[model samples]
Target: MCGIVGAVSQKDIVPILIEGLKRLEYRGYDSCGVAVHQDGQLRRARSTSRVAELQDLAAQDGVAAGTGIAHTRWATHGAPAVHNAHPHFSHGPGVDAPQGPGRVALVHNGIIENHDELRAELKAHGYVFLSQTDTEVIAHLVDLLYQGDLLDAVQQAVARLKGAYAIAVFHRDEPHRVIGAREGSPLVLGVGRDEHAGAFFLASDAMALAGVTDQIVYLEEGDVVDLQLGRYWITARGEVTGRFQSVVREVRTVHAHSGAAELGPYRHYMQKEIFEQPVAIANTLDAVTGISPELFGDGAYRVFKDIDNVLILACGTSYYAGSTAKYWLESIAKIPTSVEIASEYRYRDSVPNPRTLVVTISQSGETADTLAALKHARSLGMLHTMTVCNVSTSAMVRECALSFITRAGAEIGVASTKAFTTQLVGLFLLTLALAQTRGHLTEEQEAEHLKALRHLPVAVQAVLALEPQVIAWSEEFARKENALFLGRGLHYPIALEGALKLKEISYIHAEAYPAGELKHGPLALVTAQMPVVTVAPNDALLEKLKSNMQEVRARGGELFVFADGDTRIESEPGLHVIRMPEHYGALSPILHVVPLQLLAYHTACARGTDVDKPRNLAKSVTVE
Candidate 1:
């Protein structure tokens, strides 16, 4: 994933562009750069480093302009180098200029499928490519098509593109003008208000434009927007005519979390997000007075009643949340549920039933694979669709018939913490709603579940209190290169999430397996050097999980267990136990995952790894 922020404002846009890139850093990037129209010429500075470094470089170069475009790139077509970084330029016919600052400056967020063909065509037209990037091809094409108007050139350039892209382009000749277009990627137009009324902005997310603007226009598929100092215009592609026409898009007021992105007391965003879970869960469930289908959407009751089975589709941590919900839906709602990875589901053949409700789970809601899978399921006649998403204005919410918006605030860490737990809260609510519709949830059962839901925030707070103990465990874990996680029943998905967190942040080779499968194969890999972490709840699987713990100990493998209070598992040689304050019954997974997050965070800290921006990972997966 990449981030784009462009602005046409009266003030010095360099600071705005750099600050916007800083806010977008959670999305992940390898290199960053900014291009500005300064004194009748294009001035830019790029670096293969963090956005903070790029900011310093821009300041050192005195790169200031009232109109500019900035980019934080996670490389796809080229290596992570200064030349491959964006705000790529095309010098056009003036290839022999002193520094070749170029005429067109462009920043792109997605991929170009036919860049090879376009690169060949541009080379034939005497356009030289400096950077080895698909984005460079677009810049050349835009410069080649420029016939005096920047907007027209960008529109014509995008018309020839063959894949997903969201681009912000500016021409040096066109002062105070920036043109943006989105096809498959996400783009938003921020209309500045009050003191900043004369400014206009385009960003990959509304978070990038926080404080500067609260009003956002989410560009639809194939929409092009031209931003000027005081005004903006939008044009949408006609489906039948295949031509762009002027259109009016709704500008919705968005209250972005301007302060949440900051790291206050915590060492990293991952640590801050882990500690923020209790508040995040409370905010996500703030509107729940009682469980009802209307908690999802207007026609959720009708959709729940009509569906026979549930099909859950998601990617990464969202998929694991879906996996946990499968147990809840089957046991509580008496509905057969199947969870599928969105990327694989979209490319494979599957039986899609119209009576089966397809539920999509995503934090950003703009996850490209999950969005494509939702459409694929629709193509197979699965009409009933629902989404558990964090962003209310995301494409997934707009595409689904029903949605539960999680109020996880802004998850700045590349490794998700609060967002994963909040998604489980949404999914559990969906399960209760479906159970009510199916006559499985009685009045008494509903009341008890509601009470548990109300106490969840406090339960999570207690779990967070165990961070000191988890930190001690992390010190030992930091020395190991491999880890194994185990769980049974509903907590098995929690184990998977724990392993994922450790691997993602700490760069350890971690694997998760159902405890029952240990004897079959995983036992061979258990040794004194390997750390086996287990989620041992006081449920029916407790005895079986104890037996699996014995299996690990017999193989000389050290065990770290997160056990419930009632479980008599004590801390002894070769075994370490961290007891829970109480047993949460059905909602135990949410509480159990907190310490695992702490373990990963502290372990990454001990190892001196990048806890917030882990290597080769991004917070939001907007591309397939």
Candidate 2:
């Protein structure tokens, strides 16, 4: 979970790298540094706060540079100190090389899974390393592998390396060119006319390159780019490959930008994102007409149709989304579905085999654990691998045999608001596609489902209007340190995600349980001091959730209920009820999840936490 950017230009590139790093700091802010080659000398600086401070220093009047690489790091190997920051350098072969003129520096994203082995190999070659970071291993490895050609050295080093990585390296000899490679993490190339007028930039994401220059080149998973003085292109080794070009869209329309001035005037990104639910849902519905039953390919029907069992793999919030999706995949598709956390899926002795349809969910395309699981499943010879992801051209999408794109737009909030709901929308649509293919749902049923799906946006709007209510509810939870969320059937997973969101941002010890599981264990945690947030959508499980709420009430625990308008479920003495608009079938979960998200967001805000950048968490986990 780090950010890397590189630029090759015929003119000074200090300003460009500095601005790019500021935009990219959201990816990682623990530590940052830059390496720029100027006047036949390579200069570097690193710091721990934000990228702007040192970057501002790097762009001094006389600090003219033609080529440079920058990185904002999220620590994995060492602590988040200046020493562990990216643009890590070594004179000759180690970090403490005595500040010499001739030196090499490297910036990296993703993990070097076999760095220990590589480090031992480098040490055997008499390459003394300084830093404790796994990244230092790569820097030395590149030096050992560097014979004459810089591009070839990077290529050979990457070939010998194991696991996921996006790397940018700079050397004194090859000061005019910036070399970059991507395996699991994202790397996009920004193109310009020439170095004088235009330059090519390599960044972790499209947003980092926004407004600088939009002419973009997207790198394929195994492809590497060589950005020389005047031109750049991707290559597998020496063979050039075609680049994936995309248009740059404005960050937001002028009206949406101005209207969302305070981000809906919410206190934090979490709260703002909560209020964005109605628009997010509306956009999802507006963009999707209906998935052509054959959206994947010709054999899609054969793989998806008449499935006997299903397996779902994902990490974090996406895993919770999968948990809720299991209910619909089983009930609607009439298929037995088992949900597995991606990190643990392959490690366990399990059999998904050839019959099961494995679906993976991820907000960003590059979740390290989830990607590892995807690769392991591929090796197991699982033929049908599908994904539901927000990123269009992520590693996960490229690897999956079939995929659905979630149109949630950019989710800057690390705690994830729209990503969860958009995933639900995609999964619900997938269920409909599978049911129709399996002959479980008729034309009338499909039509009714679509009609209900169309109304989801309106239902979400109903929930959005209750923000003042949620804001008021936030006060009651200000002093709370623990909470329990309960739901049954379709919403069981929603409860889990709700609890996860609250704990993620608020640092509250929250646990979620299927209302059915309460009698078994979780009920023991309920007390007058603990708040119980229950998703009580009016459905087959509504009565069951109602009974569970009574169980919580019996223990004198506080209750916060979100139910449909007609359920007539009123708030009990220590309980509070927030009513939702009516929607039937699979659509309710998508609507029901909106309020729970808001509750967690408001609670976190009331408790005064860094809602955007939560403690000890990364927006995307690029290393397992």
Candidate 3:
């Protein structure tokens, strides 16, 4: 996982490149560097720190470059260091190039799974390398086989590439053009007001290009593009080509959808997103009003007419949403639904039939595995593919047959909060649609469900009022080195998600187990020194959960219980009750989840971790 940006501009491009990298920080990086060709020489700065020392160094006076390439690297092939940073360059590979600098420089993203084999081959050809990165191997390989044309040489080298990558390549002779290509990861070209006066910008996320310009053209898999300031040339893998239609029209996403944001008043994006949950939930419900007649109301009762099964594929928080939706789909829609990790789903040989609908959930709509799943299922002739996504114009939305856009605006945090809730809202709507399609719901029952759906935003608002209480609880976890979360029924999945959030950002060893399974195994890990958060809302499993609580208490374990307002969880001894709004049942997970999100957020914030960007995690997993 790495973030890359390159620009060929008439003006000095160092400032623009650094600004782009700062926005793409969510992609997670151990080290970052930026390289610009200044005064006919390639100059760069890099470091490993939260301070972005590389950008600071490059921003000083006398640093002037018209063309540059920048990278925020997540270490995979080498230790984080100045030497191993990107813009990997090579000249002494084999025979010198017929043209250019006898060397090539490139910034890459994604793992070249066969890099070891490729390196060994090049080494035998007398190509020596300086860095341990797989990317370094590419630079040498390209140079070893270099011909007169740089674009052809790049395509030749890429033909040997085995895994995912998005790269920005430049040569000393071809100083004005930055050639880019992608097989799985993301790359875009940002054009400015005066065409050639603009820059060729490439990044893993659109946010990287947001400040400089709002216009962009995204690259498709197998598409190679050659760019100068104002012009872009598209080509196929082997032959020169161009897209039949431009990325969009002259209008700014005129025929597209987008999320609005208010970044003016928050200390951190996570805090702002947490406060936006209510509106986000409402936005998801509002979208249902425009659902196809065949998918909503009485007219939409035939698509699931004979459907008997469902599959949900997602990653990270979206996968947890799938887990919660499974509970609802089985109970409300009476459909046998299976929740799957997107990476595992495609690798398996199992295929869905025409009667089965596949749902993909993602916040950015660019998750690599989830997109693969959608492709794999559709390739097997399952045209019934739908996506619940936050970004309206993401690749997933464009690829899926049906789409549900989540209302959660800009979720800058690596650990999702509002996106999780909004996805659940979309999933619930899909479940109700399935029920209507299967003829399992009468008009009155549908109305009742609609009313319940309308109440969710209010419920979420009520949940938000508990932030002060959740903040108080953060103290116990701020210094915690390990934690355990337990729940049963629908809330069991929420427990897993809560633990995952803590682990992802806080680097705590957190585990989640079904309350009933505590005695079977996890109980052994429980101790007075460990914090065990139990989700014990007054649902059907409340009494059974109480039994599990008793066992923990008997084991001298510390407990943090989140329960309904009227529930009888005692605050005596070592127990603490995080009281919920009221007697919540199946929907309690959505409400109960807010506190845990807050807990993890504050814990990471208190620890002074980059709660928004985190480590080794991109907001959008554009590459697998």
Candidate 4:
């Protein structure tokens, strides 16, 4: 995953490129670079440092070009170094000769799967490469194919390439234009006008162009775009191979203010988002006086009635949310449901049902694997697609037939907090809506569920008050090397998420199992040295979960339990218990997860780990 931003305007665009890169740093932050066309040549600055450092380097280098492209790279092909940073350059055919300046600068996101083959071919042509990045091959390929038109050269070069990419390239000779293309990765155009003249920008996401422009045009797959001062055109693959046709598309305005990455009065974004659960849940259900299929989108009722089953595709934290919803969709809605890891779902030779509703979950809504899985499902004749996402302008929302936007604003933490919980809220609402459509939910049942949903904010607030208790447990957990989490029924997925958080941020080895499966194998791993965390929600499976806890205690394993108020589990010797304020039925996972998040956050603090931006992780998986 990487970030790409390009600009073409009458004014100097170096600042715009740098600012946009700052907003996009969450997508990638391994290294950064910017290249601007100046003095009839390409002037560039690259650093194996943060965007702030790159900005300083650019200023020191005085890279004042009217047109430019910038990149924040997450190393995919090589180690993170200055040479591996983006804004890769390619000199013209006269690179070996002393001639006029002819150079091209390019920045790319996604992988070039066939770069080794292309690089060997380019090396035979006497091209010299300075970096070990696949992106460098693209610059040389475009340079060799340049026949006067930059857009045409990019189109031809990309056609011969393989694998996913969203790239932007600009030549020193053609300083007024930037050529961009997308195959499997995301790229968008921001259309704007200033006092002096019109401007156009290209970025991997809209957050990069927050205050720059609100109007955006999402480039489609296999699309090439030409961006010049005031105008841009998208070219799609035509009827025949290698043939292209230009088409016009509508520019949609988005709420740019909603995606602002502001950390207001909080030590870390994860903490801020954890505490914002109340507001995030309230805002996600805002204006929802009652739950109905129409709450998703227009004509959602028709799709709900027609679908016979549900198929959920997601990855990482989103996948756990889907698994948790599977319990709800089947038990409450009486609908058969299957949750599949997005990356693996498409590769398998499974049967696709047209009557099955495909539901995708993502926070950024730009997750590459999930998006590909959704497209694969659609191609297999499943047209009833829906998404639970945070960003309204994301491609997942645009591609789906119906969508429910989660009001979790700007989750900048690498380890997701609010986004995951809000997605659960949205998925739960979908389950109730489907149940009502299927006549499984009576009017009284609907009112009861709605009442619980309305009180969710208060429930979450109460759970957050247990942060001090979680912090106390974190001190002991910080010294532990291994942990095992246990839960049952709907809370099983919650146990998995808790384990994931602990390993993701604190770097503690952790595993989770449905409490019933502990005796099969995990019981052997329990010992005095290993701490066992249990999600003891006071539900139908509470007694069974308690038996699992006893199994752990029999092995001399210390127990840390977040149990509901009604649960009679007491804190005693070798048994640590923190009582949850209450057990909010059917929505207990949302409340139970808050303590787990705080535990991970505080344990990471105790262990001196970077909680907000975990090591070797990216916030959004935009590249597969």
> Evaluated with lDDT, which candidate comes out highest?
1
Question: How would you encode candidate 4's per-residue C-alpha lDDT over 1-624 as one tens digit per residue?
Answer: 589999988888899999988888766468999988898888889998788998899999898877899998887888999988988888754463312333888999888999999999988887888889999999999999998899989989999989889999998778789999998888998898554248899999888888888888989888899988877899988867658889787798865663447878888778888999999999998878897999899999999999999999999999999999999999999999999999999899999999999999999888989999999999999999999999998889989999999998888888888999999999999999999999999999999999999999999999999888889999999999999998899999999999999999999999999999999998999889999999998898888888988889889989999999899999999999999999888999999988999999999999999787677788888778
Report the lDDT tens digits of candidate 3 across residue range 78-170.
898877887776766444532233357789988798999999998898877678899988888777667767777777788889988888887
Measured against the true structure, the TM-scores of the candidates, in listed sequence, are: 0.98, 0.90, 0.91, 0.97
lDDT for predicted candidate 2 compared with the true structure: 0.77
lDDT of 2 by residue, 209-284 (tens): 6666656667777777888866676776433443333223222211112122234455566667666776776777
Clashes of 4: 0
lDDT of each: 0.93, 0.77, 0.77, 0.90
* Candidate 2: C-alpha RMSD after superposition: 4.4
Residue 585, candidate 2: how far off, in angstroms? 3.7
Question: How big is the positional error of residue 505 in model 4, measured in Å on the Cα after superposition?
Answer: 1.3
Model 4 Cα shift for residue 58 (angstroms): 1.0
Q: List the residue pairs that clash in candidate 4.
A: none
Tell me which residue pairs clash in candidate 3. Answer: 27-618, 195-230, 294-300
RMSD (Cα, Å) of candidate 4?
A: 1.9
| Shift in Å, residue 373, candidate 3 | 3.1
Global CA lDDT computed for model 4? 0.90
Clashing pairs in 2: none
